[model samples]
Target: MTGALKVGIGGWTYEPWRDNFYPAKWPHKRELEYASRHVTAIEINGTYYSTFKPASWAGWRETVPDDFVFAVKASRYCTNRKVLAEAGESVARFVGQGLVELGPKLGPILWQFMATKRFEPDDMRAFLALLPAGEAGVKLRHAVQVRHDSFACGEFVEMARAAGVAVVYADSADYPAIADVTGPFVYARLELAEEANPHGYTDAALDRWAEAARLWAAGGRPEGLPYVEAAPPPNQPRDTFMFFINGAKLRAPAGAQALLARLNAPA
Candidate 1:
């Protein structure tokens, strides 16, 4: 990549991704700033699992640096449904509060949807339409992480491009080939298995990622198709996120760090 490669731990709250060593007993609120010292970013998991007060969010914003960014998971109300919900005041309230509150600090809202056996273009269309209608005319990074195997086809890519959304690239057990991932917006949900993926940063993988990143940086950023990564490090150091998705506990974040190292290495 021409510009600096954005690199960071996957998250901050969890134990294995962080440390209880220096923290005072049980309460550890100022973790984001601490994590930023060693890493560049993190996916905000707390927003997904539970609601946060404005004060809590403000505290988080205050903790991080200017360059550090946060990728927030869209709440259950938005992503859990097969079809997009109607445009209601409550929906506006949920989105508006977040958009207004998070402001520039928010990296991308990862809209991770439930898996379907078959691709439903209608469902995808509805979801795209339902997204906050321009978030009060302000554009912040946004992306969709669809989990169905059927969503990996050329049709799916075309649909996303037409709608100005991104189909996330992921490593999972459901797809025929994880190697099939290809798209403009690169929201890479990298699942790390040390033995399964030795070293994680293969030369070919680095080359592909580097090219994509370079292209994305050179004014090729897809609208609402923000690229994101959610891989925790393998050894679990440096406050990476550990999400337990579909019974697979993505362990420590060493792999993600390696990815960052590779991506940022001298071109």
Candidate 2:
């Protein structure tokens, strides 16, 4: 738990958030400005559907605070390819599109595969190899979100670790949850938000997650979470990222804010 704990929602442009999360009468254009001030990180989902101009990326960077980080979902053109190895050009284009404009605010690039996509170790290895260690001198981080149940195996974890790629810890009933920590950092997408609890998750759930983040930051695997391996190897501390997404989306911001409060982390 020596590093930072970043708790945030998937995206800030939801229509429901305007009434529930944003300040009353807040300008729509200023939503990013406001959300950035309240959360440490944001998962940019728009990029997953389409590409943006370089100016758009630069403008987004200017809108957020200096310490705020944005984790971008890789474009479908890249992740949706049949052969991952053939996606090198698409990967380069996606990265070069305007990610550099995001600069230091850029966080990990999430590569979410189709639900039908099964685990192919060789393809996965090639895909991971395409992920650049750094772009224009700034270190790059990549997280793979494999939805198929076949990915719930020790071999997949080993392959991810070999490629230095992180296997996203997806907390969702629809997908197989793999809590293994393959990289130095932990990426979690919590989809258990409850409408009954306006803060997204109840106090007890938040407490458990806070404790888990501490454990991960301390280089230890948190007990109770689903894992392919028995335990993670002892290592140095890591930065932990937890995002509240799906399952009562309107309550996501509240859940993120509540978790941040527990971690004693700045928004």
Candidate 3:
């Protein structure tokens, strides 16, 4: 379960998820199952954009293997704006059924806020109050990927620690603050498709990251570790979900394989 952390792909790497490979060409169910065969984890972006039915969850559970994990995005309607003040029942349902239902396969419910947004200390308070308290018997991670840089202040950490939530170190165009924090719980959303279409983390980049991961593996608690990846596009990163990296959509399977190879390769 723990070998240099796990690697994953976004569920709908391309719009109409079935489209990246070919909307009109490939079978729907087969593509996901095929993808699952390689990577053990996937980020579920759809849950954020839309709600899901129990049948869908059951079907998804059946599709993914026991070892596979699903990281879901907290519904945008609930977290993006200042709606946490009204998270109420609808939001609870979204988190409980969508996130908790995944059982052990659930990784983290990533609450990714929009860029223009800011964390009014009050908003953070409302958010924590609304979030599911997590399982009494388990320790599931809850991460917040704040887009605006303001949340990076020390006050945010206080908020996270107060709620026992993990602050996600998201790789995006915003303030690189995501990779600059630490806490009891940790989540890192490595984004690749943002910078140069492809991060091209030369040997130097890979080497540096490798060293850091090695250090983390060896027992060092740095803020957030940078994972190499590409962000979707300005037009749609989360819309595609996970593998929004540059030069690697139709070829996402290849990209995941490559990253693993690099991770496993001896320094």
Candidate 4:
């Protein structure tokens, strides 16, 4: 496959979206269905706070369209540990908690470290090594979100690339925005959305981000983003996942839809 581009929101279940994104009088049970139809993918935020049962995973898989995908955020127990290496069992358990049930609909599993968590080379390397290539004969993709500035080095990018794991490109002032492409795919979190804009981002901003995503999909780094390396590789194809999160939370779904349309529209 050349690669696919997914644009979506952080989650589908939000009360605020009822009056804004979702249709009035819509059933809660149908939220996923409606949201999935509007966006190509969604970042499952619930998984970050807690684990779910196999039946739940299966039901979620059945709720959306065949082309819809979900990127799960790993639980805090696995990534927010005092010792990263010791989180092996937690990681294993989290994966075992029925992620495979999502089947073909499962996208990348995101591991987000806390803002206070610095990058310790050995510890980070050990943790990355512990991440499985696949589970139950199903291949899995992974992305890491390190909030520390220490992760902006070439070593971190090299290590992640060697493990075939992507480093999440978070667009926010609070976190260290690292744009290093370290894997076959790219994971991005656009956190600059504003509540004032019902569409999440202005048209000019959307245009800029759409162009940036195009470059990334073509295996080139986008300008105006900080990078560990000066130059990117040739135009090799890569799958891309872009999410509108942690900013203007209420307008996120609208922003996701806008970006999705932009990505799918004619050049």
Best by TM-score: 4
Candidate 1 lDDT by residue in tens digits, 1-267: 233345444566666344332245534666666666555667766666676777766777777887766777777676665456442443455566644465566665677766653567776666666665357555655567776667656666666666655455554555422222233233556553343443344557545554555544342332222223222112211111112122122332444455566556796
Ranking by lDDT: 4, 2, 3, 1
Model 2 stretches with alpha carbons more than 4 Å out:
265-267
C-alpha RMSD by candidate, in order:
8.0, 1.8, 7.5, 1.2
How many clashes in each structure? 9, 3, 7, 0
| Local distance difference test, candidate 4 | 0.89
Instruction: Please provide, for model 2 over 1-267, each residue's C-alpha lDDT reduced to its tens digit, 9 standing for 90 to 100.
Output: 386677888877889887669988899999999999999999999999989998998999999998889999999989997788889998999988878788999888899999999888889888888998887777889999999999999999999988878899988989999998998788999998889997978899999998998888878788888889986755778888899999989899888888889889552
Count backbone overlaps in model 3: 7
Tens digit of per-residue lDDT, candidate 4, span 30-82: 99999999988999999988889999999999999998899999999999987
Model 3 segments more than 4 A misplaced: 1-4, 13-26, 135-139, 181-185, 194-203, 217-219, 222-252
RMSD of 1: 8.0
Q: TM-scores across all candidates?
A: 0.71, 0.96, 0.75, 0.97
Ranking by TM-score: 4, 2, 3, 1
